[model samples]
Target: MVLVTGIVYKQVKEQTCGISFHRDTLYDPIVISRIRPDGLFASSSLAVGMQVLTVNNVPVDDMTSSEALQLIKDTVGQVSIVAENRTIAVAEAVCVNAAPLVPESRQKRGFIILKQVEKSYSFHGPMTHDMVNLINNNLRQLKLVHGANMLQFSLNSSGHFYGATNNAAQRVHEEDFIVIILETMELLGWCLKVQYDRSPGGWQKELFVFHRMSE
Candidate 1:
């Protein structure tokens, strides 16, 4: 996203061809990732075992290790990367066709939280920080307040970034992720948050949702 510190539509001979928008970063070569469940397009760049620590200007470093992990799980969308030199504009993020969960799904929905216990298959390029940008950017588009629980989501997200790892079998660490599922007993009309132990090399299970129940 292109960020102009000054007023909008102001003429800057330097950015002659560019027009300013709001204070937010704007994209030129807008990039989008693959679509995942919940109408979100997950980032193709995101890989499992990747640890993200920040989004845009938001720093997750100050957060507890557990808190940081949740942020990525909850967000969906892309980010804007402004070149230091202002030579170019790029929306480097995971783009999604994201929409709100359907009423049926929401009624059925709940939340889950996962912690990264291992950093097994780190990609050659793009660290968790890069993925953070993508995650944060995606969240911005959704207009959702993703705090520590940002990435704390359902089982659908597991395989998306998992297969990309070369050593998929050995990638995850012991107790790498704490899996929690929110299941809706349709007959009972109540949601159940089921906590499970995620084995080192296995993926999380299905539909049981993971959204937090509000106070």
Candidate 2:
């Protein structure tokens, strides 16, 4: 799962290759979040979602994002990078299940069913107004919204809600599960869960779940 690539860039002009990195915690491996289209790594085998293992022959498995960036910045001439491809790791954790047909009445009641797939993630929770708004906003930003029933979204390795889309007809209710089909293997990170209290002086509680799908 380890991949090696070389990137040559002017150190004087570019402090670090046009790549953004993210890590969930200090012990977590630094993951490539985004790559600039004009950057040196764009044309290389390096890609987003890959974990950084070393930079310029220096081991970075235990380094923070800042430390890794600094190492890359101090390198001269051509910089060699070693990364770990997590596709296989993600594939091992995926569980296959049969697809279910959701009726219109069930959809209105916050029931959602996705197409059958070899790789997919299912999330169970109570869908609230705030959750709906968040999903709609993210989907709109990613431009994945097409109609009332179609929805698509993606999360980074750190479990950050990056993209999502869902129409008004489909609502999420308590104990309802939403299944998402994965186009590519991805490391499932912690996802945010929200629950609202319906009693007097109601309050909302937030929870985090690992290896779960986001709203």
Candidate 3:
């Protein structure tokens, strides 16, 4: 059976989700090879071997790697890219309908964190010191101390960008990211400072849910 995910709204200007793919065995399920700090659409739910079944509900199984790649690259504004595990059931392609998990922060910044994917983006380089400074500088300006607001600091692990939640257990090299963690403890829970990982090849997982737990 074909599964369909919900329609989400565009949160960030560029959904620069740090996810990249490859099909080692034809369209044998597009492999999630790299998820950098840039690809915000990628979440923990989107792991390494998840198979991409469709792009916006259109099956990509018949297309060439380049063609499928282009299709994924071309998606915009709340488009869904569905994927599932080959060894698993069709019911598990969570990426298919990325509507609900995706968050948008227009008007005023809400408590939710947004996933910004840039399909046509290019990596700046071995992430540089200047870049780290800039990232920290900009994130510092967010004034995340206002509310239960949060931002996920996407750090590069190996070649991929893993979220702050996942990087703790991996062999994460500090050289890949700015070495600083922002925290605040207030009557209104703890102050959690967040920043988007701009380095290419990073994945943005589901919106930060730490706020709920804090409450």
Candidate 4:
């Protein structure tokens, strides 16, 4: 709803709170977003489904999403937020990718990271373990050496992953594509670490955390 309501939300430019949000219309103009454990959001104690009522103490009830987001972006240093009956302290991240890369063509050397600011994606598909394992196997055999590469994938209408590498030297492999894409992203600082967890139809959920690479 934040996107449709014409709210001026902050897209992470230099630093971020490690969150992705959507407006909740059922109550006062509150935002619904995930606060990761990376210590970037209002508090480490914040959980999913809690409504964000304010940012830096500005009333969000009358503001659009963009306005609220911009307010958060404008405030720097220590940020205090009141929500769900307690106040939380959020400190802006001090570190950046010191070796930030410049955008260039695939044939050129570059850097890549997967899954950007948001942590997860929700899609409806019968994606199976066999399919996932195949991708991993493919990634282990990749030979691209020119540019930095990251995973760029989306769920098509037919419930299949249409995947690609953003800046690799060679074209995407048709088989085991997901593994190849994710492995390339791992070459960068960003990648998925699949773990064992129970989900519907014998599929495991993916967990991602954001961190800056050590130089």
Query: Candidate 2: where is the Cα deviation over 4 Å?
Result: 11-16, 88-215
lDDT of 2 at 185: 14
lDDT of 4 by residue, 47-91 (tens): 444446666666677765445655655555554443452221111
Query: Lowest summed lDDT over 10 consecutive residues: which window, candidate 4?
Result: 87-96
TM-score of 4: 0.37
Q: What is the C-alpha lDDT of each candidate?
A: 0.25, 0.43, 0.37, 0.38
Report, for all candidates in order, the number of backbone clashes.
Answer: 25, 2, 27, 7
- lDDT per residue, candidate 3, 28-128, as tens digits? 56644444543455444555446677766788887744456555445666656676654542122112311211122211122323233322111222332
Model 3's alpha-carbon lDDT is 0.37
lDDT of 4: 0.38
Q: Give lDDT tens digits, candidate 1, residues 15-117.
A: 1111111111122222211111211112223322222324334554455433332333333333321211232222112111223233343333343232322
lDDT-better candidate, 2 vs 3 = 2
User: 153-189, model 2: which lDDT tens digit per residue?
Assistant: 3444744323332423132211111212221111222
Query: Ten residues in a row with the worst lDDT in model 2?
Result: 172-181
Screening candidate 4 with a backbone cut-off below 3 angstroms (N, C-alpha, C), the clashing residue pairs are 7-65, 7-66, 8-66, 8-67, 9-66, 110-148, 135-179
lDDT of 2 at 209: 27
